[model samples]
Target: GESVGLHLPTLSVQEGDNSIINCAYSNSASDYFIWYKQESGKGPQFIIDIRSNMDKRQGQRVTVLLNKTVKHLSLQIAATQPGDSAVYFCAERPGNMLTFGGGTRLMVKP
Candidate 1:
């Protein structure tokens, strides 16, 4: 079985600032890792993703990074807004099934 978790349970950032969410996974052989944003009462939505071969990948206003050496992954969101507030986590596939990580809540303050 695979397991993943975040270093911090909650993070508070001022509106318009950048936010970085960190995750650590136990499976080093996972092929792909995805960052997901989960809003209240809603399922997680894809934010960005990075493959095991790539060190970093960027999207519109977000970036995903993977460090295979340390089995760490991160999601960075630019210009944080109230709308960006959510529980951020990751899903990794070490084998056939998807293993989801514990979430880190992001709070944006005006």
Candidate 2:
């Protein structure tokens, strides 16, 4: 996954509303995760993500939450905007392997 310091991707919402994107992995040992935002033609841009030790992390307008019990991950964006329009996906690191998820398109209305 992009969590390996590598790729690319968003969710749709109103300009002033909050957006949440989620992912689930089968491996419980996955310790590191990353959230990526990929624009139309660009590679995935790292938004906010971190190690498994923390239950939650916040970056700028984005927040990431990890639920190890269910092996789930989520991203929360506050006050989403048109510029935030893009594709979003998550990558989790299980040992030396990086797994990426299918991305969701984020379209923000004016």
Q: In each prediction, how many residue pairs overlap at the backbone (N, C-alpha, C within less than 3 A)?
A: 0, 9
Colliding pairs, model 2: 1-98, 8-44, 9-37, 9-38, 9-87, 9-88, 10-87, 10-88, 11-106
Candidate 2, run of 10 with poorest lDDT? 1-10
TM-score of 1: 0.96
Model 1: lDDT to the true structure: 0.91
Put down candidate 2 lDDT per residue, 11-105, tens digits, no spaces. 45788999888787666677799888889889999998779899999999999998888777888899988889888878887778667787878
Tell me the spans in candidate 1 whose CA falls farther than 4 Å from its real position. none
Task: Compose the digit string of candidate 1's lDDT tens values, residues 1-110.
Answer: 66988999999999999999999999877899999999999999988888899999999999998989899999999999999999998889887877888899999999
Which stretches in model 2 have alpha-carbon errors above 4 Å?
Answer: 1-10
Measured over all alpha carbons after superposition, the RMSD of each candidate to the real structure, in angstroms, is 0.9, 4.6
| lDDT, residue 34, candidate 1 | 94
lDDT of candidate model 2 versus the reference = 0.79
* Residue pairs whose backbone atoms clash in candidate 1: none
